[model samples]
Target: MVDVGDDAPTFSAPMTTPSGDIEEFSLADATDDGPVVLAFFPGAFTSVCASEMTTFRDRLDDLTDAGASLYGVSVDSPFALEEFATQNNLNFPLVSDIAKEVIDAYDVSMDFDALGVEGVAKRAVFVVDADGTVTYEWVSDDPGIEPDYEDVEAAVGDA
Candidate 1:
C-alpha cells in the first residue's frame, strides 16, 4: 500500500468525466497546481460506491475550496463510469483501471473469488500534494467501509 510521505507513483489512464467525455487523466495533471484526492473504490454502481461517491460530490465545494481536486478510481470500464457519474450527478472524473495496472502499481488490488471477481481495486484514498508526494493514505479491506471525509478534508487543507 502507498504510504504518507512517499512519492506518488505517476500514472495516466482513460477516465469518464462528469461531462461524459472520455479523456486521458494523469496524476501529474491533477497535482500540477495543488493537491488531489484519489478515491479508489472496488467497482462502480455498487451501493457503497454510490453512497461514497455521492458524499464526495456533495462535499466537492469544501474540497475545492481547500485547493484540491477529486477523482474516483475503479476497475470499471469508462462507459460504466460515465453512467455511474450521470446517475449520481457527480462532477468529478472517474478513472477506469480495467487492466488493473494502476491498481497493482498502487498496491490496492484485491481478489474477490467468492464474488467471482479478480483484480478489483480496494477501497482506498490518497491525498497527493503538488510536489507529487502523498500527504495522506487510507486503505480498507472491507469494501463497504468509507474513508473519513473529515480527515481527507483536513489533509487537503494542510497540503
Candidate 2:
C-alpha cells in the first residue's frame, strides 16, 4: 500500500460528477494548492459504499474548509457512477476505476471469492498533499467498516 511520505502515483481517469457530467480527472491537477482525499470503495450502489459516500457528501464543507477535495472511486462504470452520484446527491466526483489500475497502484484490490467478485477495491482512504506526497492512508479488509472521518479531516488539515 502507498504510505505516508511516499510519492503519490498520479493518474488521469474518467469520472462522473454530481451534475452527471463525465470528465477526466487527474490527481496532480487536483492537488495544485491543497490536499485531496481519495476514497476508494468496493463497488457502486452497495450498502456500505453508499453510506460512506453519503457521509462524505454530507461533510463536504468540512473537507473544503480543510483545503481538501474528496473523490469517490470504484470499479463501477461511468454510467453507474453517474446514477449513483445522482441518487446519493453527491457533490464530488465519483471516479471510475474500471481498469483497476488505480486500485492496484494503491494496493487496495480485494478478493471476494465467495461472492465471486475479484479485483474489487477494498475500503480505503488516501490523503495526498499538494506536492504529490501521500499524507495518510487507511485500508480495511472488511468493506462494511468506514474510515474515521475525524482522522481524515485532521490529516488533510495537517497536510
Candidate 3:
C-alpha cells in the first residue's frame, strides 16, 4: 500500500467515464485541475454501491465546490459502467478496471465474500491530494459498510 504523506505517485490510465467518453486520464491529469476523490466501487449496479454512488451524485455540487473531481472504479467494462452510471444518474467518471490492474495498483483488490458473493474490489475510498498523494484511505471490513461522505468531504476540503 502507498504510505500516507509520501510523495503521491503519478496515476495515469485509460478509462471511460460515466459520461460515456473513453479517455486516458491520470492522477496527474485530475491533480493538475485540483484534488481528486477516487471512490472505488466493488462493481456496478449493486444495491449498496448504487446508494453510495447516488449519495455522491446528490453531493456532486459539494464535491465541485471543494474543487474535487470524483471517480468510481471497478473491474467492470466501460459499457457496463456506462449503463450503470446512466441508470444511477452518476455524473462522475467510472473507470474500467477489467484487468484488475488499477485495483491491484492501489492495493484495494480483495476477495471479498460480499453478500456471500465472489470476486470484487473491497469497498474502499481514497482521497488523493492535488499532488496525487493519498490523504485519506478507507476500506469496508464487511463489504457492506458505506464510507461516510462527511469524512470524505472533510478530507477533500482539507486537501
Candidate 4:
C-alpha cells in the first residue's frame, strides 16, 4: 500500500459533479500550487459520509487559510451525488467514481457480497503537497470517525 511520505499519484480523470455533469479534473486543479486534502468515501447519502463532508464544508475556510483545498470522492452516480448535495448542501465538488478506476489506483477498494464492492472506494484521506507528493494518507474502516483536522491543517501549512 502507498503510505504517508510516499509520492502522490497525480492524474487527470473524469468525475461527474453534483449536477450530474461529467467533467475531467486534475488533482492539480484543487492543489492551486499548494496542498490538497482529498477525502474518499464509499458512497453518498450515508450518515457517516454526510457528517464527515459537512464538517469539511463547515471548515473549508480554515482549510483554505492553511493553504489546503478540500475534495470529496465517492462511487455513487452523478445523479445520486446531485441529489445528495442538494439534500446536504455540500459546497465542494462531490466527485463521481462510478468506474472505480481512481479508487482502485489509490488501493482503497474492498470486495463484498459477491459483488464488485471491491471497485467501490473505501473511506480514506490523502494530503498531497504542492509538487504532487503524498505527504499524508489515512485509510481506515471506521467511517464514523471524523478526520484529524489539526493534523491536516498542520500538514498543509508546513507543506
Q: Per-prediction TM-score, please?
A: 0.98, 0.98, 0.89, 0.85
Candidate 4, residue 88: how far the Cα is off, in Å? 1.1
Which regions of candidate 3 fall more than 4 Å away from where they truly are?
112-119
Writing each residue's lDDT as its tens digit, candidate 2 over 5-70 gives 999989988999877899999999999968999999999888999999999998889999988999
CA error at residue 55 for candidate 3, angstroms: 0.7
Kindly state the number of residue pairs that clash in model 1. Answer: 0
* Residue range with the least summed lDDT across 10 consecutive positions in model 3: 111-120
The 10-residue segment with the lowest total lDDT in model 2? 12-21
Task: Provide the lowest-lDDT 10-residue window in model 4.
Answer: 110-119
Task: Say which prediction, candidate 2 or candidate 4, comes out ahead on TM-score.
Answer: 2
**Regions of candidate 2 where Cα sits further than 4 Å from its true position:** none
Model 2's lDDT to the true fold? 0.93
- Please write out the lDDT profile of model 1 over residues 1-159, one tens digit for every residue: 689999999999999988899999999988997999999999888999999999999999999999899999998999999999999999999999888988999999999989788899899999999999999999999998999999999999998
How far residue 96's Cα lies from its native spot in candidate 1, in Å, is: 0.7
Steric clashes per prediction = 0, 0, 1, 2
